[model samples]
Target: MSLTDQLMTDMKVAMKGHDKVGLSVIRMLKSALMNKKIEVGHDLTTTEEQQVVVSQMKQQKDSLVEFQNGHRDDLVAQTKEQMAVLDKYMPQQLSESAIRQLVQQTATDIGAESKADFGKLMKAVMAKTKSQADGSVVNQIVKEVLS
Candidate 1:
């Protein structure tokens, strides 16, 4: 089933089970997806749907960190639950070593010898990794590889 279809199914299940948190997360995701669809003025492709999920996951992670820093345990727990719900839709994340290897190999392939080639290296690596790797992790790997 498509992600949206799966989400709708899960939302119904959540409603029947009285899973308030799960229902809330699903509703939030649906809203984000609809907004993204409207923004692009078309139905989201599979890749675009994944991008929307990834973007929402990123926002949740950022909020989790902020909540932790502020010692807001309740918000932190809620954010973590939301993240868990969103995680079901995200592609498997790359490990640090995997990202490093990808950056190293791509750098060599593109003849990226120094930081001067940062942009080129990043473009190539990001193209390969797409939603599988985090941008900050890829950036660090590229920097480390180039240095």
Candidate 2:
């Protein structure tokens, strides 16, 4: 089934199970997905849907950092739970070592020898790893490799 259909099914199950947090998270994701579809003026392909999911996950991660700094333990715990739920929909994350390896490979492929080639290297690496690695992680790996 499509991600949207799967989400709708999960929403129904969450409702029946009396899972309030799960239901709320699923509702928000559904709304985001629908809004993204409207923005693009068509049904989302799987890649577009994955982008929407990743966007939501990024928002949660940002909020998590803010909550941590604010020392809001309750909010932090809640956000962590929501992040966990969001993660279920994302593609598997690449490990730092794997990301480093990818950066090395991309640099070799593109003949990127210096920091001046950072942009070219990043574009190539992102195209290859967009669905697997986080942007910040990839950026760090690239910096480490180039430096």
Candidate 3:
């Protein structure tokens, strides 16, 4: 099933099971996806749908950090639950070792030997990994590999 269909199915199950957190997260995801479709004025491809989920996950990560830093334990727990819900929609993430390997291989393929080639290396690795790898982790690995 497409992401939307999956969300719809999950939404109904959440409602029936009285899963408030899951229902809220699914509704938020549906809203984001709908907004993206309206913005593009066309049906979203599978890649586009994944991008939306990744974007949502990124926001949740940022919120999670802020909540932790602010010592809001209650909010932190809630955010973590939201993130858990979002996780179900994401593609399997790349391990750090896998990302490092990809960075090395891509750097070799692109002949990126110096830090100056950081942009090129990063673009290539991210293109290959798509939404599977976190950009910050990839960035750190790219810098380590290039330097």
* Model 1 pairs in collision: none
Better of 1 and 2 by lDDT: 1
The order of the candidates by TM-score, greatest first, is 3, 2, 1
Native-structure RMSD, model 1: 1.3
For 1-147, candidate 3 gives per-residue lDDT tens digits of: 899999999999999999999999999999999999999999999989998999999999999999999999999999999999999999889999999999999999999999899999999999999999899999999999998
- Which 10 residues in a row give candidate 2 its minimum summed lDDT? 84-93
Per-candidate clash tally: 0, 0, 0
Candidate 3, position 14, lDDT: 99
lDDT by residue for model 1 over 64-147, one digit each (tens)?
999999999999988998888888889788899999988888888889998899999999999998789889889888888899
Sliding window of 10 residues with minimal summed lDDT for model 3: 85-94
User: What's the TM-score of each model vs. the native?
Assistant: 0.92, 0.93, 0.96
- CA lDDT of each prediction against the hidden true structure: 0.91, 0.90, 0.96
- How are the candidates ranked when ordered by lDDT, highest leading? 3, 1, 2
In candidate 3, residue 112 scores what lDDT?
Answer: 100
Candidate with top TM-score is: 3
Compute the lDDT of residue 105 as modeled in candidate 3.
93
